[model samples]
Target: MRFYQATRFLFPGSLRLRMLALCSVGTHIPLLALAGWQLATGRADWPSLGLVIGATLVGTLFTLLCIDALLAPVRIATRAVAALEREQTAALTAVRDGDLLAELVVGVNRATEATKVRIATLDDAAHRDPLTGLLNRRGFLTRTEAARDGTVALIDLDRFKAVNDQFGHDAGDAILQDFAAYLARGVRRSDCVARWGGEEFAVFFPETEEGEAAGILHRIVRRMGAGLIDRPDGSPVTCSGGVVALDGETIGQAMTRADAALYAAKRAGRNQLRVSDAHIRLD
Candidate 1:
């Protein structure tokens, strides 16, 4: 048996063909040796020896044909698995019902779907703020690349420390969440609102001019002065904002100018918007 198995290395073909070759060699080699010994000893005639050789050749051909037919389904299944690994399609179209290969294909499709869902969930968590559900500073920077030629605004809540002190931290948290929602609602679909840090937020308006962005901020200021934002103790919430144009300026430079303008707004009053002229060329 071991010698017959070793015959597989002599042939270059699929496992089915190699197995057939091994079986044929094992059977014929022994029968031919027996006939040769019988004829030399005058125990078998030439006619009987010819019959033995012809029978062996016919049997080998029949066995090889059967092996090829039996392995056809296995070859198709192998190709289907290769296609799935390449991410072409999830379905194994050639697979039939009530077979082990069909079950394996279904399991593979389910796993692929699960992997896709997990990746999406992780991406959302990475870009979102946990407390207010707004875009975090990193997310804001990543999504605001298209605002390079538009406007950037930095907003700071006025007297927000007093809110945290007068009320509780929980009340302060509620105010922040409500204010974030308000900012989102006031902006257009092309605009982005992000929580810059504690008590501060950033907005980016893509393809918008400085004056137009300032006008929008002014509206937000008027709304704040109207006491629209609700608090736990019925107190009014107000915010100061600074707007700057992104013309020929890097994001860092734009943010610095906007921050300076925000301080200017705070110094002038608690509820107003300031426009920065830092990027203006005197030429």
Candidate 2:
């Protein structure tokens, strides 16, 4: 057994070859020992020895071929497992029925699917706002890191504190959610809207210039001022916004200018849009 174990490296790195080598070694070792004993006792003739050796060799060859045939399914299953480990486009659908390999394939597929679902759930929770179903501040910042040129808008609800005081917290929350939905529907799919904080929302329009953004903001302001959003007591709910063009500035700098413009709009009246003229330094 020790000699057989040491000679394993003589065979190729294949399951079939290793099995054949082991079968041949086990059959020939005992025959060689018996022939040695017969020669020492002077009972082994050349013809008889040659015959025995030839018959044993033939039997060993036949047994090795049978072993190779029996292990062919195992070799296929092993290759499938290797492909999966390498992330190659291989499917284990051809596993034999009621076999251990079939059970392994099913288990592996289920685990992969469950892992994908878990990752998606975690990602959604991390990026989405719980109340408004929009992107939160963190998610927005992450997305805007790649933006080169566009428009940034900061919006604030007019007299939101009065609504919460007169109606209730629930009503205030409902108003925020409704405004978020309205903003989402008002913009293109390429735009991003985020809840920047309490009573404040931020929007990013990618690849849009100042004039285009101003026109869009004006339309939104007019639509909002026409009493489209209502309070519990049938009062009109309005919002003030500040729009600024992205001119080689970071998102943080653009947001600062927009916020300043938003407050300026709030001071000017209460339901209008203000465009910022802050010259962005191209750093």
Candidate 3:
């Protein structure tokens, strides 16, 4: 019976029904032929013919019942596939012992579950910054490195600790957010800018030299120092920066040298821009 149901999958459902009906007639013809031979040999009576008809009817009914039982699995499979198409997480719940169709449905459900989990993992790996959505340190590094040959600058906001010390961490956060926005707009689209870390920001100029980067930084310092950031009491905000060219050892090394110059700027005055001396690389 199980084998017959498994074979039914190879045929259309309507054709399967017609085939089963034909099987019933085929089964009856052989029995009728045997009964006719017995009556012809004078070894059977009309009563024998009646017995043959009854047996055929009973056997046909039994075969049809078995076929219907086997079909239960097919019906369950069709419905389960429909649910899977609609819900994406549907599983086979009507499995019977010794049913191959039931096993196939269970396997499909397992594959679907695994696929959903993998997709979610990939999605998480894409958009999120490995460090912080505050833009990862790597993302900033890649963008700055790709900029056309130009001057690069690093800026540090002065006296940033006073906010954290006097007003608490909340005020420090607000200040950072405000400063980040201000810095973003201060540079040109051709330039790259990023928040390096607490109170420090870096800028890159495409197709520019140290002199050009220094000039831009000086203008920005004066603008910011002249009370560019609005506050309740109008106390001025000041920044110090260092500018350098890309013609040195490496981008990282150039940044390190720029930091030294930035320290020099901060030591000289609260608001200033200092350009680092150019260093020629042998390699």
Candidate 4:
């Protein structure tokens, strides 16, 4: 048995076939040897030897077939478990009234469903903003770790504090929610936007050139200006942003440059976009 286990890799077939081969070799070889001894000692006739050999073959084949049938449910359970590992949402199909193995399948299916729900809830909590339903900073970093040749921007709402002070925190919350929705709707499906913290946000335009990113950001801001939660004066809500091509820089370095450019935008005039050079203008 140990030798068989050690060399299992050399035997290439389904588990059922391998098990059947081992069982046949273990049981049939001794019985055939005993029959040969009996015949040599004149205790059994050749015709009786033939009958014994035939009966042994028939009995082994039938028993092995039943065993293979019994293993089918175990195989199904194994495959279902593997699928769950590969895909978080995977589940097992329902099994009707059955024996102990069938009950096991049903139990596994129920367990899989429970695990799926728990995982979904945990994932959302880990990666999502509770109030705005946007991806949080950690999520943004995790999802875009392998990104290349894209543009990243740091954006700030101009006069966000003034809005909070004048309208009360509830109204301020409304504005934030409105802003998050606007960002979600305005960006292309391929772009990722995150609520970096407070009134600051981050955006990534993957595989985008600096010029193209500039245009997309401007458009998004322009639309956001008119659509956000209303101010009593009805002046459009505006934002200042700084965008930088990822180029060869780490995201942290690019964000540093972008932050500098953001402050530059805030200093120059509240509502505009700036580029990485700190000296370059994106008017």
Candidate 5:
């Protein structure tokens, strides 16, 4: 293997080939001169000259053939790499002559498979919320096209700041997690939930009417808010939510309306569900 790899410099298609050709001529020239001198002195026969020429031609042909065989795998590898760049995986079948190159091709295929799996796993992790184990903003939007003709609800925890300030951020995180679990329990399998950042969560009800979506969000707000969070002091925590209807607008715009309704709910009084309507204010 080491010899084959090292002799890559001896192959054609390189500046080294011209240098090698020059060296071959230089070495063979002196030998031919000596042979001619022996022939002139009547010490060498014509048959011996023929034998030398034949030997040189056979040796050169064999060397060039071996080098060409070695480069075949490299060419195959180059094409395989191009395929891998275009797609995620490509297999090299050109090196199937039961040689070391075949082993290398098999290894490369296995490595490419592993790389593809690892990339897919990373993509999934990147789109998922680490804390709530729900879809993050990017993931939600990626799947939003399939979720059309649906209503999206923005669920913001009412007085979430009080929880963070009073019970500590850790406790606030725990409260949000608990709320997320409760909300999950309230939603159907057709619905998708996403952590839209901070204490705000968005829910998508696919192919659902506005009234049906409102009832579902109402349940989520009531059940999730009524659920208690056990603090370090062994006390309970509560939350509220704002719901909004969604239509042809982008998810961000729909979320803004929901957030506005959430703020309005907080302003009206904590622990209540406020649904956004055209008559409502930003409060």
Candidate 6:
């Protein structure tokens, strides 16, 4: 490494230059010794010495050309690491086996896989609400960006501030976790639920009609009213929701209507669901 660093001034990113330098020094040292010995024994000849020098130069050039092929594994690993550092890609595998540097390649392959998993874990954490173990708003939006054809809802726990004020934030946090779990259980694996900040949550049902989505939300509301989880005030935990369809709109576009409908449910009394009138109706 030190040798490469020094030689890099003359030939940037050329490890072969260093290798050729070493090879020339190694090959010529013996030649120097032989030449000195022959001269001391009165056997020195210019023709023979020139021939030896020509052969050494040709051999060194050939060796340098051949060695680059043998360094394929190193190049592969280098590129993989570079890509990973930039967070451009993931899920790497060994390019091949049975190379001279197969062990290096295999090690790099394992390292890349491990790195990808760690990166995924960190990304998940960044997008999650730690208290509820559900996707946070950012995660929700990221995951549903491509899922434009779906049904979605925005839900807010009714009078949740009363619980936080009366029982303290710890108890409030517990209620939120319970609410998140209940929502998760109510939805299918293909569905998504996220904590949309404070006591609000978001749900997405991909490729679903508003009617089916409404039915699902209604059942959840019914169960929640039955005290699936109670508030710190010993009253039934209830919520209000606004369901909207994404027939030809993005999640962001639907969120406006869903939020409006959610507020409408909150106004008309909580523990109910509403939809955009003259729009997709789950009623």
TM-scores for all predictions: 0.64, 0.65, 0.53, 0.64, 0.64, 0.64
lDDT of 2 by residue, 1-283 (tens): 4664455465423435666667778888978898899999989878877887899889988998887678677767655655555443544654433343343555467557656777889888798899999998888988897787999998899999999999999999999999999988888899999999998999999999876776776777777788878999988889888889887989888999998888888777778888866422111
Point to the candidate with the largest lDDT: 6
- Model with the higher TM-score, candidate 2 or 6: 2
Best by TM-score: 2
Error (Å) of candidate 3 at residue 148 is: 7.5
Which tens-of-lDDT digit does each residue in 38-119 have in candidate 6? 8999998989998998898898788877787788768787666555555434433433333223334445666667678898
Model 5: per-residue Cα lDDT over 45-164, one tens digit each: 778788877777666666666666777767687557545554544455544333434445555676678678889999999888889888888887777844446677777776677778
How many Å off is the CA of 186 in candidate 1? Answer: 0.7
Clashes of each: 0, 0, 1, 0, 1, 0
The local distance difference test score of model 2 is: 0.79
lDDT per residue (tens digit) for residues 21-110 in model 4: 776776689677978788789797778778777877787788789988888878687667545555444434433233334445555766
RMSD of each: 10.2, 9.6, 9.7, 8.5, 9.5, 9.4
Model 3 TM-score relative to the real fold: 0.53
User: Which portions of model 1 miss their true places by more than 4 Å?
Assistant: 1-106, 278-283
The pairs that clash in candidate 2 are: none
Give lDDT tens digits, candidate 3, residues 154-269: 78888888867876877667666776677767777677666677888777787886776677667778888888864333576678888888774556666888788788877776
Residue 90 displacement (Å), model 4: 12
Question: Which stretches of model 6 miss by more than 4 angstroms?
Answer: 1-107, 278-283
Candidate 4 lDDT trough over 10 residues, lowest sum:
94-103
